[model samples]
Target: MSTQQEQLDFIERHLVYDIFKDFGPEASLEFHKVECSNGLDGFMSALYTVTLELVIRERKRTEVVLVKFMKGTEEFRESSNSYIQFANEIFAYAEILPAYENVLRTSHLESEVVSNWVPRCYFARFGQVEGLSNGRESVLALKHLKNDGYQLGPRLILRRDHLEAMVGLIGPFHALGYATRILQPQVHARLRAGVVDMPFVSESGKAIFDVLYRVAFDRFYEFYDRQKEQLLKDTDPGFGAAIERLREKYFKQPTQLLEWIRTNSYAADQADSHFATFLHGDYNRNNVLFHYGADDKVDGIKAIDFQELRFSTTAIDLSFFLYMNTASEGREEIYAELLRKYHSHMIQMLELVLRRNQDELTDDRGAELLKEYSFERFNGHFKRYAFYGALVCMHFLPWLLGNEKDCAELSRLFDTDMHGPAFHQLSMDIAGDEANEEIFKIVRHAYEHGYMDEI
Candidate 1:
């Protein structure tokens, strides 16, 4: 293991020099001081908060940046089917977001604008570090949003306004994808081509998924059994059977829909035109940071962590946010309202793109175009992946809701093997948390919406 000083030395010599060279000659940028501190711990990367005192072009300034490094253990990095994750993150920061913004900037959309919903990326490199070889030393430097008054939401339960704030951000994000598909077909195609094939579709990922599914399903069923009385009483009579059927058909098999998504993930025929945009595959409460306004209410939200970006429907992002963060009470109360707002923003953004494209609204062609990009079509695709929403909740809620100690233990346990008994125990512990009712609400919603039958 490298000493702390050694790591600091590496940052100063390599990272700092790279940033300085971007502006002008190295001498033009004088570095005076540097300090580094631990950042938020992620599952697959180590983050550092690097502060720098510098003079550039006679202007003295202090800069703080968050550096993400693929510094996981060799065993975990190699074993977890992480080959494409780093590349996916780098692609999102370096290419995808910029392309989306460029589409907006170049368009004649008088009413709409592209907001910076994610942190500004300063630099991204793969296979740069000398000793951290085999693509393990990938690094990303991003503006530290926390320095600008952004903070994480309470992980236990997200409030209604917080959920709305996130919805507001994601709505435009998905709309960009829809707009790009219509306005700049070539750009959209290029982005679609670049979506990293989810590791779970591969042979090794298949093995991992097998183990992961078994343990995840076991925990899920255990949670169901524990709450059988209340859930059956409060939910539809079909709840218990639907859960069991999904376990057997989807989780046990694991590929029924996996193959479908893989085969059709990128196909863009009008018949099944659901795969429209680059989705933040890991949209959750922890991945979003909130900016509080003067009233102490959340006024803005920014997303972080792009390792799970996928060329999929907006529903994937929407369902993940809704099920993962919002409590049952909040979801039940505001689910329709949230969807309506998200759909409205998406339509507004799409209209801007349509206007820029100069597509005639009175003609049959324009009507077809609007229908193709309609919210009803998007809802159809979202419901199709409702099974995935529930599955992700079962696999993720444990870690998200666990206490610090439990989270640490759970992370350490699952980092190596997915099917270990200890993993199931920890997952069960997570499902047993009272917060699980929130997730159950998601599952219940899915069933009520006929997602259970469709899956």
Candidate 2:
């Protein structure tokens, strides 16, 4: 059968037949692709936007759903561990999202309604499908959000307004996870059961990180050499020593540095476990869509791509956005203000969950809860976040700022040494392409604040 035929049969078996039987006995269904693209992120999945046309009772109607299918190549499977990514994404749609909504509904708060903050899934299935020789097909079909007036954020540079809108949306997303944990512990456990630990901690992920870490060390040293005379003149004699220490961390103990990052990245109330949440792990500009209003200003945001979701502290999600999305000048000016805004919304989301359980938060009660999962205390690991930002610039910035041709080269990433001249130049080019200053400022700020003392 043709690919289209296979897809039609798949949809009918999974979705249309059940609904159409009620619409009319003589109903018929057909679907055609409206848009198709290889995923920009390179590893998790490829996308196809299709419109399903249904005719029944002498009338016709249409529904559009975006289908995400796991990349079927062995290269992707081996390099990124596609199975784990697919499992997390499928579990996110099938289990986590529903549990989050249930928590909201039970809370009886203003935010109780299932909002458009995340796309609605029409159908999600994983495991065997008849057609493919591998017999494995993992797919998620969600409502076409663009049809509802959402637009992708700019790829190269994000505006201050756009960054604020993302923080506004993601803050509640993280809070909802926390509220679910407090109010619906059983459901929270179920959600956690579906997610694996952070992938970078895995052996394969660490191998990749090792390469990028070296490149980042070199990138920093190259910057220092370029500014050595000026830096020494402006600061204490130990300025060069500090940079040398950073270089040594990446060169001699890259794995230990990663461990340091992971260890301090989360906090625990007692022993063994940290305050955890379902994270939108790849929370960058491309993964977020904005809904615009009368003046073409952003009114709201909808986050996409949950393949990287993991159970982690709020700081992981919060810091990823701050580091990846905001510019240096703007980030320093609004850093504390933006964090406060996110923390405030997090509290509001938790309040709604509290209301659902007939537990109102008095000032003392709120203070105690805050102390238990203190935003300020948790975020005190700003150096870890800054470290993560620098590392991403070593690798991700190239792809983020690359053209289609550049992204194609990324598909062969593991075959090449990331610290080699070709890859190093690519990183430098992307950094010089208006991306380096922000990361430098973030790292320097961390040093100035003594946030790196723990490491």
Please report the candidate that would top lDDT against the real structure.
Answer: 1
lDDT digits (tens) for residues 235-340 of candidate 2? 6455457667767655554556655555555455333234457887767788888988898888978888877776765555766677667666666667667777
- Candidate 2: deviation at residue 181, Å? 1.8
Give per-model CA RMSD: 3.3, 4.2
Q: Considering every candidate listed, which one attains the maximal TM-score?
A: 1
True-vs-predicted CA distance for residue 45, candidate 1, Å: 0.6
The TM-score of candidate 2 is: 0.83
**Candidate 1, residues 301-385: lDDT per residue as tens digits?**
8899888787765666777677777667656667767777888877776666666666434456556777776777767766666
Q: How many residue pairs in model 2 have overlapping backbones?
A: 1
